[model samples]
Target chain A: MRFLKECKADATADLVYRVCPMHLLEPRELIKDLKQGQVLEILTDYDGALEDIPAWCAKNGQEFLGVGEDEEEDFYKLYIRKLH
Target chain B: MKRVYLDHAAATPVRREVLEAMLPYFSEFYGNPAAVYDLGAEIKEVLEEQRTQVARLIGARREEIVFTSSGAEANNLAIKGAALANQKKGRHLIVSAIEHHSVLNAARYLEKFHDFEVTFLPVDQYGLVDPQRLQKFLTPATVLVSIQHGSNEIGTIQNLAELAVVCRTQGVLFHTDAVATVGQVPVEVQTLPVDLLSLSGPALGAPKGVGALYFRDKLRLVPQIHGGIQENGRRGGTENVPAIVGLGQAAALVQGELDAKARHLSRLRDLLVAGLQERVPQVLYTGHPVQRLPGHASFCVEGIEGEALLFMLSRQGIYANTGSACASKALKTSPVLTALGIAPDVAQGSVVFTLSQDNQEDDVHYLLEQLPPAVERLRSFSPVWRKKMAAVAGA
Candidate 1:
């Protein structure tokens, strides 16, 4: 959660996207693996992640947040990386 | 260009004339019809006149028109009333396997709570029920036969006239849930020879919360809901004056434009069907070709799940359905399609489009543009489909 905070604040950085496989890791666990400047990406199809992840990051004093959908379920790569 | 409405079977926009007719009733003539004052009596007079208009549309007597809150209530009244009133006649009731939940559930209630025996007659591949099979179920204990005039999901138009004739010859009362057909298609109670019928206002251009049941003068049905003696004592409540008036005006409009609407919808539907078939391969078009509602199109795509496909279309601002308007997007398999002997995969992927007269060539093009990609994208990740494809490839 601490690393995600730094990555989101990095001004010169492009969003480093870390896409966890849908089955491999949960969003919270995956967010924990990122370095302070690297972004955290989550691959989740659960619609709740859109609001839950962002809200969790804000409360935990972290920056990693949000989701995107694909028509193909497995291809729905949630873009997350360690930033803050 | 932005979006198209192909869910007219769900509900329709109120017509300009119907809205005009209803606006005054909400304000100027808002007095209770039960009052004896001129203001109330005048509203009562208009309500009765509208009742007469509704009756004329269905070829029934004015007194036989019992207005209810909706199509489901009307259907419940028809099934339960006949079941209870004719209990002594015999408790045997027969209905189609693919009836709206209103009919099926009502029958279930009677079978469960009341001591009534219910038989559900099945449909064939095209969703058409055989009248002969219905006849076979009619024993001396048979009290009523209820079938839909047109299926909401499959769009197959049933031959009510033939079914009615068979029931009449057998001295059995017949009813039709004509909520899908009344205003859009020609429904003449006298010609159809049906003993009782149900129709909804919202299916055409009238407001929701208003529908009617048509019963022959001699046919007796107990009131499903008991309250104050209203609706000529057949149904009890303050009349939905504005909504009923709106229904009358809309029915008048339908009577005038029925042929034109039919022609326009048929042309648009054919255009859509031809374009979809040409664009999308491995898609099966369901519903009877000649005996179908003009604006209805239903298809079963080979590889995509319907809810996912519908969600994709929603993103593109195109509204349609898989099976009934009431049950789509919930990922529930359509009972109507399943009853037609469709397999689980095909039934799960079935989608229905019921267009209004206002839809055009652009809408068809838009759907054709969006659908194949949606199908391909959905198919790519579907494990069941991928496995089947791999097997086919190996074969």
Candidate 2:
């Protein structure tokens, strides 16, 4: 798992407390709105997203930009760059 | 005998237009909204259209509304969902003391199992939560505040915008249970800065099982019901298509006729209030006289139990309630009236009359004609009334 000190994203999908499969489904829909090569941040509390997101990104040909660290927030902030 | 129903707060007859709109969805257009086939896809579009209609009634975006089984469910979702989701920020929550059981119980549930601290904010004599007092209770640990927009028992409407602003400026989430106000008055989310609001379908002349919660855009709520991706995975289980359709139709119908309906109901309400006040001795009008629902009037008649009065009225084909339907059968003084500083004995006499557009002036006249004699009969049999009258005569 790659970690980043600070990463900027073009858009963010906040799936913090929304139930599972939503962690996967919403990002797919939201990333469609982002232009190619633009970064999208996904916020989720579901632990499964940590693995599913990166694996899904690899399968879908999107670039997994690694997770950002935020001590203040309880949820994980995973970043991805849309690669078309 | 003319049958008079002045308990719209308890329930209302589903409007004809709403029923007509809902019937097709149950039989002909019945399709699982989550299914991928043409039947399901078409129903999905219909569901979204209902979302849009419900949203339009409250000046909200279509995506912000989530249909629930009832207003109680919506209240649970708002209080528990928002609180659990934002627990990382704080563990403290605030709700008015006179809030519905759904909210009060949800807050209590959080406190009991989730280790969250809840403050039941006090209200004034008129059941109005004071904004200044609300601000005093806020701490950095306070994450959310739930206050009902109107009191179903007392007919008092809170100064929600002012109360909501205090929470907003303090960075705390504000939620209002608008089940009592949504259809009876104009409740535009654009004007009120609440993060969440709950409204009922029965309040809008729709079937009882339907309600909706409106959350401000991008507000995160932890799913209260766990399952597949229904309600965008916010709430699980297949959607109740027909009820949602009914709520939407009712919302649309009410929105078009709101102002006129308010005028009509309030006119009948005033007549009832005036007639009761003039005819009945020692009748205490409850709640704020002016800052109330357009069609609600509540009173407490001294030396008579509300239950006995209801029995008498029901015999005369006049129907009403003693505060809440759930609590009335418990034969206890209403906590709402007690919170307003009413004595327990007086609170036992609490009677609420909620009007709808369907209620006519003749209905009010019928109530006026029957109520005085009923109160007189009950008072005549009461030792308390005799003692009070004897004391007055001696004085």
Candidate 3:
């Protein structure tokens, strides 16, 4: 919540796509609408996605802004700057 | 990140020697063994030789070995095949509660499809099957008794010889899914008194897609896959020549270095277990301390999910398994751990560290150094830990 609201306020990144460990395929589809250089934030509880999202972003020519591992919430916030 | 593999029970990297032995079969000797050509005849002879080597590993005759695609398929053949073949003698079967899914599902299939009765015998807190309990279930109609030689999750090695004797005395066929124990420990078919034993090649440093089923000469099993007279008409299919060659090499290597590898694995396992106990005080050992597999060190850490622990460990390049590999993906507590009489909450935290001779003591040290912090970090986020702490504070 608070993070989603913060994501909305930033003109560069307008929305946040949420994902979990069970549904991993959603991230690619979620980021499809965004134009080049538009930032996207992903909130996920899947530990694998923390490493995977960055690698995927790099492979696809997107900028990976690194992850915020919320140790308290046991979740992660991954920011990617999409470059088509 | 520096990587360490601690999940040998699940799978292992193919050994170099095994791979080398397999290469020629894949390319040069690519002819089908069933064909009448000279190349095919040569390949067939090689396959028979490989069968002999695999048979030698467990003290079984080459003719008794049936090459299968996996341990699961081998288990299916043993359980269903035996059940179907012996239906006239008995319509009832018995299995231990903690058998792998292959055996359990095969028994269920028999019960559902062929109108057979199944009895699942319970295990003790240490996951040991009581022979007396097994005796209570055995009757004149009991056709077969299926149990695992060693549990993949809890590492509990059953008193299989005793259990096998009980089955033999009652004229019931005995089968053990020795997938987890065959290469890791000594499993002599000649002395074990079991009618059938399932083995996985991948579990023994060979390639995947190859396994073997050892059936006693006198015991009859209906062919599950009927067509060609392959595997002495017990299992039908084109032989996986490369994998079979690899399996043969792997089995021979394991048999030769059995004692040394067992000792090495035991030492590594003990060090890891002792280190974890010393570092993480709340951890509970889940398996039989002495009777378990030499390479297996399993535990249930208090107040943390096994997957979360595995994730954190994976980040540090230390990979481990939670529950049995077959059931780990489901996010359910292991039935094997539950069979050990553990609480549901504790059972959810189960982690198994299966070592092989390939792993060094330094890997265990690396794991011990990193594991406590991972557990602590995960426990901090766990609601169960908070609840327990709150109760403690209130008290």
Candidate 4:
């Protein structure tokens, strides 16, 4: 697990995205509204996005903070910090 | 947690009898039917016996049955294989708009890759392909007509006898993908006048990866998979002996107990449908009320998301399907629903309950008790529901 030290320090995200399974385009569109230095947390039930979001963050020039799991099975919490 | 499973159309639990029948093939009787030995001959005899059993279920000759890996493969072989083989006779084909993706994609593939012309015949609101509408599409060049025996999502059983008669009158070969109907409904090839039929084993209580294609005597098709002279050189591959054995047992069970099983399923299905109608408001029945599959109960609520409702139901230990998972990449709304002229918004709430002989009235009662609140809770998060409620309040 990627421990979210940066997210622990920040404690608050500027935006929250409830990602729909197989429909990541919606969340990708939502992320474009976030400003630089703002933290965005994505909560998703899709098993695939647990591996997908960090790579997407890196490619888009965003900081990959880490991920967290919710109490629900297969539901995940991912944190990303916008760079530009 | 009390679990209620109502997705029999997508798949069903492999019956105990089928599993028992298949057990020996996996271990003791593990011989290749192609080998030139006693073991092979014995295994081959059993395989042919199973074929006879399956053929009996559909009122067909044992020689006419060709084993396939799946209903999809059977459909592909039926549509593409037949069309490719008979292209010299004609290049045009007809299939219903609500056919399973296997048939639809096979037709599309032929159209795209081989310059074959395919006309997709539209269905009525209940998803029945009108014979008159189909007549308009049939030309002298139309060599084949592929229509499903029933709609998987909505559960509308077609009048295959009437449809096949139209095709026969035109001298066009008719193929019915009976994956959803064969065992559940009375599918007697002796009565239907269809040239080819497709069925998956899993749909009839056997394991997945085993299916059968019924070809009328003297009907010729170019082989889809060519290698070994298996399936009489029609489909080339090692026969799945165990799965086929399971299929045989499943078919025999269905053939013997079809009426009793159908009665049980219809009773449970009716209870669920009636319960949903009583409990849920603005629930639209999706398929033909009477002409549907005995086990199927499908509906669309006014303003809730089907995926959300399904998730909530899963949490409650009630399993059901929300349209085809194949179409989930785009949206929850099914092309089958759209073909029936259902609005996109209404189609988003589609939920199908396909019962089995095992399903009881208690399962139906449980679904009725749980589903209304689940829909209401999901509707609380739905923007469409909110808008509708607001509109109602303003009115």
TM per candidate, chain B: 0.97, 0.99, 0.98, 0.98
* TM-score (all chains, Cα) for each model: 0.81, 0.98, 0.81, 0.81
Task: Write candidate 2's Cα lDDT for A50-82 as tens digits.
Answer: 999999999999999999998888889999999
lDDT of 4 by residue, B233-262 (tens): 577889999999999999998897888888
Q: What is the C-alpha lDDT of each candidate?
A: 0.79, 0.93, 0.84, 0.84
Interface RMSD of each: 31.0, 0.9, 24.2, 23.1
Which parts of model 1 are misplaced by more than 4 Å?
A1-84
Residues B231-339, candidate 1, lDDT per residue (tens digit)? 6445667888899999888877788788898898888889888888898877888978779988888889877788888889989999988887667745688888888
Q: How do the residues A3-65 of candidate 1 rate in per-residue lDDT, one tens digit apiece?
A: 222223212111111121222334455556556656555444344445566666667666553
Tens-place lDDT per residue, model 3, B270-370, is 99989999999679999898899999999999899998899999999999999788688999989888888899998889898989888998999999999
Measured against the native two-chain assembly using Cα atoms, what DockQ does each of the candidate structures obtain, in the order listed?
Answer: 0.00, 0.85, 0.01, 0.01
Evaluate candidate 1 and give its CAPRI docking class based on DockQ: incorrect
- Cα error, residue A24 of model 4, in Å, equals 57
Native interface contact recovery, model 3: 0.00
Predicted structure with the largest DockQ when compared to the true one: 2
Off by over 4 Å in 4: A1-84, B329-332
Model 2 complex DockQ against the native: 0.85
- For candidate 2, lDDT tens digit of each residue in B1-395? 77999888998999998899999997899999999999999999999999999999999999999999999999999999999988878899999999999999999999999999999999999999999999999999999999999999999999999999999999999999999999889999979978999999999999998899999998988878888889998999899999999999999889988899989988888999999999998999999999999999999999999999999999999999999889898998899999999998888898999999888999999999999999999999999889989999999
